[model samples]
Structure formats: C-alpha cells, structure tokens
Target chain A: MQIMVNGTTHEVDVEEDMPLLWVLRDELGITGPKYGCGIAQCGACTVHVDGVAVRSCQLAAGDVDGEVTTIEGLGTPDALHAVQEAWIEHQVAQCGYCQSGQIMAAASFLETNPEPTDDDIDRAMSANLCRCGTYPRIREAVRSAATKLMEA
Target chain B: MKAKTLAVAALIAATATTWAAGETATTTAETEAPSVSVADGLEAWSRIYEVASHPRCSNCHVGESGIPMWSGPSYGKTRPHGMNIAAGESRIGAEFVTCATCHTRSTQGNTVAHAAPRVDMDWQLAPAQADWFGRTSQEICSQLRDPERNGGRTAQDIAEHLDHDLILHWAWDPGGGREPAPYSLQEHIADVMAWGMAGMPCPNG
Candidate 1:
C-alpha cells in the first residue's frame, strides 16, 4: 500500500490492519508520532489526516483515506508551525516525550478552531495524557498557538 | 415446550386449511390462534429480553449518554467504556475518535485479548432511540412494539433485522474472553418471530 507521510509518499509492504503509527515509525522511519497507548485513549499518537486530528495509533494503515502529516511534517527548521512556536514560548515540555503528539494535536485543532476559548483548549488537550502533568503549560501553548495562527 | 410446538404446528395446519378453503380471509392470525396464547408470546419475549439485555448487546445499546458501557463478569463492575469515548451525534465517533479506529470491520472474529472487539459489520452504538440499557422488561417490550421507538419496524422487520444484523450475532459468538449472550442467535431470532406472531404481548398486558 502507498502511504504519504511527511510530504513523501512511501510504498510499503505491511498488513492492512497495522496501525498507521507502526507504518510511520517502523516502515517509513518517521518517528515523529510517538506511540504512548496502542489504544485511542492516549493522544500521544495523534497526527493530522488532511488537517483533521486523528489518533494514528488506532487508525489502520489500510483505512487511511487522506495524506498524513506528523510532527515532522508540520513545519520546517526555518519556519516552525504556530503550535511549535507557542510550545517553545510557553516552555510546554518537561520530559518532552509526549510533546510531538501534543504539538500535532494542537496544530490540527487550531486549524478548525482558530479562535478557541480556554475551555475549548482544555477539552481538546485533555485527550492527550502527560504523566509529568504539563497540562497548564499545554493549555497556555494552545492559546498562544491559536493567537499566532490568527495573526498569520 | 413440546406441547407448545405441537400447538403451533396445529395452528399452522389450521391456518393453512383456512386459507385453502377460499373463505374470504377476514381475521388476523392473532384472533385466530387461541391455542398459541398471549402467555406463550410473553414467555418468548422474556427470552428475547434475556439476549437483548445482556451486556454483550446492551453495552453498546446506550441511550442519550452516547457513552457505551463495558460490563459482564470480566470487567468486575459495570462501567462506561474507557478512554472517555463518546459516539457523539454521529453515533460512530466522527466527532472525536471513531469506533472503527479500534473496532475495525472484519468478517474474522476477535483474536487478541484485551483489545477492542470487532465483527463483520461497522462498529457503532445502537441508535439513541433503541436504548435498552437498564430498562425494565415492560418498558423494553412496549418500546420494541411501539413503531415510534422501534425505528418504525414491524414484527417481520424486527425479525429480519435480528437475522441479518451481524453485531447481534457477535453477542452470541463474541470471541475473546468475554461471555457470550445467553442463547444462540437462531434461538433469539426464533423467539422474536414467535413473539411477533403472537401480537408482541407485554408482561402486564
């Protein structure tokens, strides 16, 4: 099957039921999307499928109907996505293991809700779990990201 | 049970003879079959309720909550499905994460332990209108008979839905460590057809 990840289409031989996360990390070696919980419970494997946020860990490779954009594909070193910039400004990362997924989720969320309220940020970001308890900063970053996206 | 079967056979024979005689068919089967009493229909309904109310079936047949449940002996206590999942308005989780994300549609049975269960049909919560979780026998019986609440399906339509719906079949043959619903799928459908034939009598009625 052909899977486009990080702006590059890759032809891969894998089971259809294989999670898109595995296809990204193992098959294509795009490790931006981390696998926290194999189930859709944890948002650590969150990615953008045609600009909509989806848990890649739960999405089967065969079922991927759109182009996938992971944290790596979100922005470049020269020009980071608004969410990435906001993350740095808010100092959202403590351990940084779940940051990529967090950034991806926020980026995707801001696309649809460019002017989200604090409550909206909380509701959306709460989907992704962080053991270090960086939710306060995460919310701040999402708020900041929303502002940046509006300006841009 | 044997007596009921014989009575039903006799009723069928009588009905067949009545039709063959070419006497203008006037009354419905409900009026004609005195031997197949309302008691028999209610008894069959009890069995149908048994399968419908089982956790395997009712867990996903949630009401306005939109939160499917996870129950039976395996889970220790009856509780909502994990991950704070909601089927939302779509009833397929299109708003947040789709049920298909884990419960992939496949003809093959659930093989992995502690993973989401799957059937050939697309995994989804039963319509809010068809909510059966925590309902009484009378409430469910009336709801099933009422065309308004029952998706406007007649008795035959209900029987056909039961026969063709793979998710209902999954209740009886749910692979994995989960306990299957009380009776076989055929038995449940047969009960439904019998109860429907007898005017779908409620316990109190």
Candidate 2:
C-alpha cells in the first residue's frame, strides 16, 4: 500500500494488520514514536493522522487514509514547532522516552484548542502517559506553546 | 411497591407452570422442532454468560459513567480503560476525542503483539442500559431480556444483533495477548438465537 508519511508517499509491502508504529519504526525507519505499552494504554506511540493525534500502535498501516505526521515532520531542526520550543523552555523531557508522543499529542490538541484551560489540557493529554510524571512541566509547556502559536 | 412485587411473583409462578408444560410437549415434538421452553432459554443463557463476562465483552459494556473498563487475565489488573478515556453520553467519545481518532476499521493482519486491536466499525462503549460490569450472570440475563435495557430489541432482533454486530464480534477477535471470549462465534450465535427463540428467560426470573 502507498501511505504518505512526513509528506513523502512510500509504497510499502506489509500485512494489512501491521500497526503503523512498526511500519514507521521498522519498515520506514522513522523512530520518533516509541513503543511503551504495545497496547493503546500508553501514549508513547502517538502520531498524527490528518492533524489528529492517535496511537500509532493501534492504527493499522492499511487503515491510514489520512496524511501521517511524526515528530520528525513536526518541525525542522533549525525551526522547531511552537510546542517543541515550549518543551525546551519548560525543560519537559526527563527520560525523554515519552516526550515525542507528548509533544505530538499536544501539537494536535493546540491545533483545535489554541488557548486551552487546565482542564482542556488535562483531557487532551490524558491519553499520553509519562512514567517520569512530568505532567506539571507538560502543562506549562502547553501553555507556553499555545502563546507562541497564537503570536505566530 | 409490595403489591407490584406480589404481582410480579404471581406472574412468574404462572409462567413457570406454563413453561413446564411447554417443555413436556417439546420433548415429544419432531426432532427438527426447536426446544422453546424457559428452561432451555436459561440453559442457553449460561453460555451467553461465559461470553459476556469475558474481558472482551465486559470491558466495553460499562456502567452509567460511560467509561469503558479494562480488566481480566490479559490486563493483569482490573481498572478503568486506559488513557483516561471517556465516551461521555455519546458513548462514542464524541464529547471528547472520538474513539475513531485511534481505533479505525480494518487493521493489518500482522499487527504487533500488544498493539491496539482494530475492527471494521466505529468503536464505542455500550449504552448505559447494557452495562454488565461487576454484574452477576442472572442480573445480566435479566437486563438482556429487558426490552428497555436491550435497546427494545425483540428476541429475533437480539439474535440478529449477536449474529451480525461487528463490534460484538471483537470478543472473538481480540488480538494481542488478550484471550477471546469462551466458545466459537458460531456456537455463541447458535446459543443466542436459541435463547431468543426460547423466550429469553433469566435463571432468576
């Protein structure tokens, strides 16, 4: 099947039930989305499907009809996304294993809710779990990212 | 309330007598004839109980809160559905992030272990009336037979639902390390159809 990932359409051969996570990491060699709890329980494998954050581990490569975006596609290294900038500003990464998923989820959440209250952030980011418990920093980073996006 | 309870008791007694007579007649009927007695229906219900109590079915058939549960042998711990997910009153998570935001139709055949299992339908929690978590088999049987609780489905409708609903089929296709519900889908469907045809009796009722 042909899937557009990070703005590049690649024809890949894999089973219809193969998760997009493996397709990204093993097949395409895109490793931003980590494997935390292979099940959807953990948000470590979050990615964007048509601008909405979804667990890549749960999503099938064949089921992806939308444009795919991973952390690598979120922004160039030279010009970081607002969320990335705020993540750096807040020093959100502790172990950094879940930061990519967190950042992806936050970016999607902010797209729909550019100015979110604490509750909104909680509801949106609740799916993503960080074992390091960087939740306070995550909230602060989201706030900062929202402000930057609004300004930009 | 006392009078209502007494009336219900009397009706059950009357039905029991009639059902006993029906069973006797069914015993002498043609071999092809279906056994349509309350006892047979309740017997079929025992099988349904096995399927319903399984994590694949019970996890999504939650209570009034509309929060799906995650428990049983596969999860290793019984708890609320992960990701702090909530379906709200919509039962489809529309009040928040919809289930389809992650669970899509038609997953790949070779999905990794512990990966989110996918099916070919829009995934959502069962309605409040169909809530089965922490319920006894008798209670679940009563609820399934109750028109109000079972979506006003008639016995035939219930059979059709069991035979066809793709989401319900997920019980047998639960990928990853999750165990499928007891019995094959075909056997479960047969039992469900028989129970419906036999008057959908509850063991306690």
Candidate 3:
C-alpha cells in the first residue's frame, strides 16, 4: 500500500492489519509517535490523519486514506510551528516521552479552536496524558499558541 | 450455529410443555426452570442484567454525556475514559475525532494486550436512551421495554440485536487482558430471546 507521510508517499509491503504505529516506527522509521499503551487508552501514539488527531497505535496502515502528519512534519528545525514555539516557551517537556503526542494533539485542537478557553483546552487535551503532570504548562502553552495563531 | 439451533428447539419444547400445563400453574410455579410466564421473563432479565452490567458492555453504554467509562476489573481504578474521549451527541465522535479513525471496521482479531481491539462494525457508544451505567437491573429492564427509551425497537428486534450485532459480540471476545461480560454470547442471546418471547416483562411490572 502507498501512504503519504510528511508530504512524501512511500510504498510499503506489510499486513493490512499492521498498525500505522509500527509502519511509521519500524518500517518507514518515523518514530515521533511513541508506544505507550498499545490500546487507545493512552494518547502517546497521537498523529494527524487529514488534520485530525488520532491514536496511530489503533489505526491500521492499510485503512489510512488521508495525508499523515507526525510531529516531525509539524515544523522545520529553523521555523517551529506555533505550538512547538509555545511548548519551548513554557518548557513543557519533562520526560519528553509523551511530548510529541501532546504537541500533535494540541496542534490539531488549535486548528479548529484557535482561541480556546480553559475548558475547551481541558476537553481537547484531556485524552493526552502527561505522567509528569505538565497539564498546567500545557494549558499555558496552548493559550500562548492560540494567540500566536490568531496573530498569524 | 448448530448449537444455537438446538438451544432454540429446546426452548420451544419447554414453552410448549409450560403452555400445556396451563398459564396459572406456569405463572405461580416459583421454580427456576424456564416456563412461559412473566416470572420466566424476569428470570431471563436477571441473566441479561449480569451481561449488560459487565464492564465490557456497560463501559460504552454511558449516560447523557456520551462519554464512555473506563471502570471495570481490568482497570484498577474506575474513571472517565482515557484520552478524555467523548462520543458527543453522535455517539461516534464525528464532531471531532471519529471512533473509526482508530477503531477499524475489520473483524481481524486483536491478540496483543493493550492494543485497540478490532471489530467489523464502527466502534461507538450505545445511544443515550440505552445508557445502562449506574442503572439498577429493574431500571434497565424497564428502559429496555419502553419503545421510546429502547430506540423504538420491538421485542423481537432486541433478540436480533443481541444475536447479530458484532459490536455486542466484541463484549464476549474483547482481547488485551480485558475481562469479558458475564456468560457466553450464545447464552446471553438465548436469555434475551426467551425474555422477548415471554412478553418482555419487568420485575416491577
């Protein structure tokens, strides 16, 4: 099957039932999305498919009919996305194991809700767990990113 | 399939014998054996309660919020579903991230632990009216009989739903160390059919 990831299409041979997480990490070698709970319980494997944040671990590679975007594709090193910039401004990473998923989920949330209240942020980001309990900073960063997006 | 057919045949025979004995005796028997009476329907309901209240079934059959639960034997702590996932009014998360975005419509077995289990149907929470979480067995039984609360489904439709819905079948075969609902799927279906055949009586009724 051919899947477009990070604006590039890659043809890969694998089982249709193989999770998109494995295809990204083991096959195509895009390892931004981590493996936390293989189930959808944890949002550690979050990614964007056609601009919607979803658990990559639960998504099948063959079923992906949308353009895929991982944390790596969010921004270039020189020009970070607004969420990434705010993440750095807030110093959001502690263990950093779940930061990529958090960033991805936030980016998608902000796309629809560029100016979100605390409750909106809570409802949208609640699925992404940060064991370090960086939720306060996550909220701050989302607010900061939202401001930047509004300005842009 | 063959076993189910035989079970249905046996049930018919049992119903016939009860009818031959007359309605009065069957209704007042007070015995545990299957019979053609309101008591039998209530008894079947008790069994249905056991399965419907199990975490595998009740977790997704949430209240008006449309937020599925995460409580069960498998989850050490009973809490809201992880990832703050909400089904919204659609009960499928179509307003935001769709359930099918992660849950596939393929019946492929999910053998690995902690992985998203797959079913051939679109994964979603039960409708609001069918919400069973935190409800008593009597309440659930009453709700099931009400056409307004039960999706306007007839008594026979309830049996067909239990017998045919793959999402419901997933309750019996949920992988990933998750405990399944009480009783085998076949047994649950039989109980549901028997309850419907007995006029879908509730304990309070």
The residue-level lDDT of candidate 1 at B197 comes to: 70
Two-chain complex of model 3, DockQ on C-alpha atoms against the true structure:
0.33
Which candidate tops lDDT?
Answer: 3
Residue A62, model 3, lDDT:
67
Residue-level lDDT tens digits of model 3 in A1-152: 99999999999999987989999999999999999988776689999988878789888876776899999999999999999999999999999999999999889878866777887788778778899999999999989999999999
True contacts kept of 3: 0.49
The segments of candidate 1 whose C-alpha lies over 4 angstroms from its true place after superposition are: A48-54, A60-66, A77-86, A105-125, A143-152, B1-36, B105-108, B119-122, B163-166
**Rank list by DockQ:** 2, 3, 1
Model 2 steric clash pairs = A16-B108, A16-B109, A17-B108, A17-B109, A18-B108
Name the TM-score of candidate 3.
0.77
RMSD of each: 8.4, 10.0, 8.5
iRMS of candidate 2, Å: 2.7
* CA error at residue A88 for candidate 1, angstroms: 3.8
Off by over 4 Å in 2: A13-18, A25-31, A35-37, A75-91, A110-120, A143-152, B1-35, B94-104, B107-113
Tens-digit lDDT track of model 1 for B1-205: 2234312222222222111111122111232343445777888888888888989989999998788998887788999887667777788865544576557555445645565776655689999988899988888898899999999998768866765666766777676688889866545655676787778899889
lDDT of 2 at B116: 55
Model 1 per-residue lDDT tens digits across residues A39-115: 66677888888877777876778778789999988899899998899889999899988899888878876775678
Per-residue lDDT, model 1, residue B201, is 95
